[model samples]
Target: MKIDIIKKYNDVRTATIDFCSHLQIEDFSIQVVQFASPAKWHLAHTTWFFETFILKNYVKDYKEFDADFNFLFNSYYNSFGDRILQTNRGNMSRPSIDNVFAYRRYVDAKMQDFLERITDEEVIDLVILGLNHEQQHQELLITDVKYMLGHNPIFPEYHKDFNLIKDQNTITNTVKIQSGIYQIGHQADGFCYDNELGVHKVYVDDFEVNNHLVTNGDYLEFMESGAYSDFNLWLDEGWSWVNKNDIKAPMYWHQVDGEWHNYTLAGLQKVDNDAILSHINFFEANAFAAWKGMRLPTEFEWEIASKELNWGERWEWTNSAYLPYPNFETANGAVGEYNGKFMSNKMVLRGASVATSKNHSRATYRNFFNPTERWQFTGIRLAK
Candidate 1:
């Protein structure tokens, strides 16, 4: 059992390192948008997480790769110490691409050595948690890199062949869930984050949720119909955002010769109407849903429906704040800082995005972001 667990943990860590190997040195430092991170920073930050949380806490005689890394890569953990200012992460070009890879190797060697010698279940659990956390960042790596590269005049492809999903017709089967006492949030789990725990019951009124996500074609219709101009179709806050930002179309979308084309990391391609509509925030999603006489699902409704469905197509925005469960308590020490601090003032996202790892996603995995933020892989699932 010990060998199997350690091997599994090491495999995940190695895969993360290997994923970084695909990018060029130049690609590692470009933060074209403020919302995205440079790929090099992501590489260092994930390593910093393991070193700070698992290695420093548990590994006897463990030495940090760089003393300054604790300050440079620490992200939002006030308990861990002051984090590098988020906006300044792009300015960190000193840790050259080569150094970042070296940092990863140092962390990797220590992690593997610890895995080989350690047999404590508590330690194993922490390793598994770290591996999972890295996987989450791995997905972010793809999205962040894409966001950065897509902003360049010469849009570069992240992968040579842009064929993760094939061109097959998606089933438009809308599933109607009966209104009743439906339990939402995390239930059975080998491992779940703190926010997903305390599986609580939530009563959902009878609602219809689309089997698949909204398509670009559906979104385009809203655009062509002047949906953005109609204040009635938008929430008060959403209308304010639209008017303030003059958002006429989804981000990355541009009209050419009266036709819509979207700029992707793969360059400007004709909008794939069948592909799930992505890069829209909660406000836009809610506005689009309202335009169609549907509504965004509440977090409970989303969880209840998502628990029974395939969720990797897109991360569905929920009409719920990322608050604690009825009787939630923080974990001891710094780990407690994980989910509690960001609970208020953020909207919850359910399911996982297309770029997300299949293993990393769960029905209860609650992703949160500000409502106006659209840099992440966000989309909408219609509920009525």
Candidate 2:
């Protein structure tokens, strides 16, 4: 058990570095937008998480790689220290990509030493948390890389030979769900974010959810139907976002010489109409559902209906607003900020995406984002 736990920890930590193998150092510094952090920042901040939370908390002789890194790499842990402004993450070039890599090596060596000597169950628990936290950032790092390269004036690919031809062969139809009371939220036998706890019953109405995610070909019809320009098809805020941004297609998508093309990690390729529609935000997903005379499934409906269906390729936006479950309690101190702080004014998404690492999600896992943020591998599945 001890050796396997260390091995599991090593594999996850190694994967973070592997994610950078495709990128040039220059590629590591672009934030692209405020929500996305520089690749360098992600690399250092994740390492900082280990150094600050585990090593510093437990290792008496540990020394920080750099004293100022606590400020530069701190990500929203206001209780611990000040954080660099999100808007300026891209602007700081001094930490140089090389320095971040060195910092990763430093923390990784210390982590190995600590793990070799660790016996406390509490330390092991925190190490597991760090591993899961790194897993979340692994997905974010990949998605952010796509945004960075895809938005370049001449669209670039993240990998030269790793083009993804997403397999999407499921029958595109809805499965009828009978009305019933259903149990929702994690049952706590396994690891889950705190927000997924407080499992409880909720009555769900009869509804039908798409057997498969909305595909590019399926979404193309909505675009052809002038969905973007139609205000009546959107929520009031959604309409404003559409007009304000002039959003005409999913992110990383372009109409080249009149045919549709999308940027992929493998590089720019012709839009595979059969591929599941991804890189869309909650607002866009909702608007598309409205255009089709359907509505998104509530999170409860999705959890109930997904057992017999295929998912996990794309994070499907749900109609449900993000909020606490029955008997929810925020963990005290820094851990408290993890899920509770951002519960309101956001919408929930269900399922894991191709970018999601294996074993990172559960049936009860809830992913949330603002209506307008779309950098993650997001897609649409309709319900009514």
Candidate 3:
């Protein structure tokens, strides 16, 4: 078991570097929005996570890699101590790209040494959590970099091999799930976040959900019907968002000479009608659903029907608020600040996406984002 864990650790760590191999040094610091972080920051913060959480606790007399890293890389852990503001992360021109890589190598060496001798199950659990946490950042690294490059005046391809929008929508039928009291949350005997811990029953009414994710072609029809201009299809808040931002289309979408195109990791290309829709926020997702005279499925419905339906092409927005499950409790300490603190004012998204790492997503995995966030690979699934 220990050997397997160590291999998984190396695989995840190496994967992070491999994902950034195509990125230039300039790309490492491109963070156009406050919500999205830079690739260099992600690399450092994930390393800091292992250094602070695992090594500091398990390794006796562990030497500090750099006393300043604790302040530079601490992300939202108030108990962990003061840190740089997130918006100011892009302003960090220091800690040069070379320094970040050196930091990763320094900490990874310590982690490899610790994982080999550590026999405590509790310590192993923290190591696993750290790996999962890095996996989350791996996805963010891809999406955040995409957001930066996509917004660039001259959209440049990150890599020709990186085709993130190639997944085609498969299921075309609506799956019927009978109303019942169903067990929700993570019930499996495996690693899961505290957010998925409160295993409880939820009563859902009979509803039909589309097995197929909404495709770009489908959304094109919505756009042709002038839904964006029609305030009736949008919720009160969604309408205000649309008008305020002049949001005529999904993020990264552009109309060139009356032809629809979108930016992908490989660069800008004509929107593929058959490809699954992506980069849409909850507001646009809800409005698109309403335009079709349907509604977005609740997270419960998505989970209940997930087994039978094909998902994972994109993170499907659910018509559910990000809230704690019954009997949910935040873990103690700085680690406790992980998911519980951000439960308010965010909507839940179900399934995985093209950028999600292998085995990183499960049926019960709950992804939350502000209603207006569209930089991530988010889409919609219709229900009634």
Candidate 4:
């Protein structure tokens, strides 16, 4: 068991490094927006997680690679200690990409040594949590890189053949889920986030959801109908967001000579009408559903119907607000800050995306983001 886990740890850690293999040295520190983090920070921060949570707790004589990194790379665990402000992550140019790589190597070496002889189940659980945490950053690393490169005026390609968008034919068919009392939350024995821990019952009404995802062509009709200017089609807050940002279309979408083009990992390319739509937020997804005389599914509905649905191309927005399940509780320390602290003011997103790390997603995985945040690989699925 320990051998398999050690191999998994090394594999996941190496995979994160491999994910950024194609990037130029100069591309490592770009952070265009406050929400998006620099690639260097992500690399160091994931390393910092293992060091802070695992090595320090399990290894008696483990030493931190750099004492200052406790503040430089710590993200949002106020209980853990001081951390740099989220907006100022781009200012961390002092770490130098080489230094960050060295930091990862240092922690990885220690983690490998610790994993070799560790048999404490508590320590093992923490190690698994750290690995899952790193996987989450791996996904964020992709979106953050995309944001930095997509916002560049030159629209540079991260890789010539890297495609994050999956091409699929339009399917207008719907799957009807009958009303029933269903058991929800994570029941599997494997690792899952704290938010998915409370196994409980939920009553869902019969509803129909799309067999596939909402396509660019389906959304284009909404755009051509001038729904961006239509107030009644959106929620009151969504209308304000639309007008405040002048958000006429999805993020990375550009209008060229009356044709739609979007920035992809492969650089700017013409939008495929039949391709699945992505990079959408809950507000836009909700508005699009309203325009179609439909609604976004509650998280429960999405999970129950997900057994038969072909999803995994995009993180579909659910109408559910993020909250604690019945009997949900947090761990005793900074680790408790993982999923429970930010439950308020965020919406639930279900399924996985093209950029999600391999074996990182499951049916009950709950991804949350602010309604206005659209840089992640998010999309819509209509329900009625």
Candidate 5:
């Protein structure tokens, strides 16, 4: 079936706005910490992406929308020009929330016109990249919003739709994966990031992986076992982070009145034990694995084993570092900077989370984060 480019573009664009519909005007620009961008900044930056890349490059006689936005919204594209500091995204209140929405509408109108008239394959490919980029940001906007709302002492609901489904995952059942030469990276005909290229063969050793994600109940057991104070279970850097942050529990988790409570999209509530664990950093995941006398799965092992297990509930952290495949080549142009630039000193995560946009991930997809970063929806699955 031919992908409906126009409909996909519109669906993705509408989804970003819908994700923020419940926000207050004050909520639009809140950046609780440096790693996340403001909700309003995400709105403009995604639009700026389309305008700067697709419309300007492909659309003939395209006019730039407010020349100053280039500096304000260009995220980490040093080749393009200087970018707004990631930590200062919250300070950009001049665009105003309403004007940001207007900016989205303005670009959407032009994008539709360009899509309707364009017949070139290369430009359509770029448009596909833009839609995927927007989808990635769509997930970020939700997580960043959750972080904003969660950290507030007067915790507010982003929306009141917390219908969490029960997950019946086991801590005992282990699926034994036999050793074989398996292929990794994106090989099928479909949309994937540039980092997923360099498709090649790899030898995966026999391994045993749990069938279900590690749940909150499981993590609670780890916590109650005095895992936090034990330096034996932690890496040197992780111990330092634990001591520095005065860490006790996962982000958004609190012990109120001697009972465990977690902040959710529907506001703070009693923590559900059955739900899979989230908001844990790579360091925590690794330490927990060490405490259990188990380890995290490698990225190749994860891709091969993902078929039979239930995933997509949390972004599972892999033991593998975020590096390119063998003999991978970076593309030429601004798009070249997409995934190649961030391949060092970062751990790779496989699978998606509840916050991921529907139909946005695959088994081979690789997500990476710094070892200390934990504000996003990250969790662990065990291997041996």
Candidate 6:
């Protein structure tokens, strides 16, 4: 079992590297948008994670893959020592794209060797968890790359035929959930991040959630009806955010000749009215829910409803902060630093986005980001 788990880890890690090879050298450094990272940095960072955690700790007499990598790729973990400055990640041109790929190969080789010799299940589980963590980054790689490329005036395509046609709207379904007690958070049976566990109970009032995400057409109606201009429809904070940011529409959306177009990795494309509205932050999502005379569901309601729905193409923003559960305990050592520190000042998002890894998402999975963050593939599901 240990051998097989390690092999799976190696396979997934190798695939991550392969995904990077799809991008051009020029694509690796284009961090034109503040919210997105350069693709090259992501490649190096994931490799740095394995080297710092498993190789440096578990491997016998393991040597550093690159001495400078400790400074170059460490992200936000003050416990690991002073990290590379966040904003300057785009400025790193010394290693070059080729050298970053080389760094990945070196880490991969060492990780495979360590995996083969390590027989402990605890070690195997950590490695598996690390691999999945890397896979989450893999999805972020695509989303970040998409955001970067979409910012270019020339508008490059990541792939020649990667366009997905908008699906036809079928039945407009609504699920009227009777308010009752429901269990929220993860139940540990398989691999899960620390923030997800704790079999806690919560009371939910009777609410009606839209069977699907609010679509582009639905949002357009709100815009046409002056949703952004009406201060009464928005919360004080949300209206302030809209005024401060001059948020007239969702990010990446532009109006040309009274028609809406969106910037995509494949260049500028017409907004698909049938598709769900994405790239809106929680503030915008909440305001829209208010405009519709509905309310955003709490995280508990989201988890309960999601357990029975098919979550695809959208991640629902819930009215909950990313906080530690009751009787919460952090895992010992560096991995403990993973989820606990960011528990404050972040909102929870349920379901997985279109860019999410198939194996990495589950109903119990909890994704969080600051309410102002809109660069992610974020959207909203309406609830009452």
Best by lDDT: 3
lDDT tens digits, residue span 309-341, model 3: 888889999999999999999888988999999
Worst 10 residues of 3 by lDDT: 162-171
lDDT of each: 0.80, 0.87, 0.92, 0.91, 0.88, 0.80
Error of 5 at 267 (Å): 0.7
Ranking by lDDT: 3, 4, 5, 2, 6, 1
Q: What TM-score do all the candidates reach, one by one?
A: 0.94, 0.97, 0.99, 0.98, 0.97, 0.95
Candidate 5 positional error at 152, Å: 0.3
| Model 3 lDDT on a 0 to 1 scale | 0.92
lDDT (C-alpha) at residue 328 in model 5: 81
The candidate 6 region of ten consecutive residues with least summed lDDT is 162-171
Error of 3 at 303 (Å): 1.0
In terms of lDDT, which candidate is stronger, 5 or 6? Answer: 5
Show where candidate 6 strays beyond 4 Å.
164-171
Pairs clashing within candidate 1: none
Residues 105-197, model 1: lDDT tens digits: 888888778778887887787778877888888888888877776777666676666433223226667777898996665678498888888
lDDT tens digits, residue span 1-384, model 6: 766876687777777777666687778876776557788888888888888878888877988867888888887777688877778888887798889888988888898777678887787788877788888888788778777876776777777655422433354687778878888778757888888877788888888777777888999999989999999988788889999989899978887788998876656788999887888999889889988888787888878887556575666789988898877789887788889988998899988877777677888888999888887788888887
Off by over 4 Å in 5: 1-3, 163-172
Report the Cα lDDT for residue 234, model 5.
Answer: 96
Residues 1-384 of candidate 2 have per-residue lDDT tens digits of 579678988899888888798788789889888988889988988899999999888999889899999888888887787878988889889788898889988998998888899999877878888888999999999888888888887877777765543657478667998888888888757578888888899898778888988889998998999999999999999989999998999887888899998888888889998988888998899989988889999998988887866888889899999999989999887878778999889999999988887679888989999999988889888888
What is candidate 6's local distance difference test score? Answer: 0.80
**TM-score of candidate 4 relative to the true fold:** 0.98
**Residue-pair clashes per candidate:** 0, 0, 0, 0, 0, 0
Model 3 residue 46 distance off true place after TM-score fit, in angstroms: 0.2
Highest TM-score among the candidates is held by which one? 3
Point out where model 4 deviates above 4 Å: 169-172
Q: How well does candidate 3 match the true structure in TM-score terms?
A: 0.99
RMSD after Cα superposition, model 4: 1.1
Model 1 worst lDDT window (10 residues): 161-170
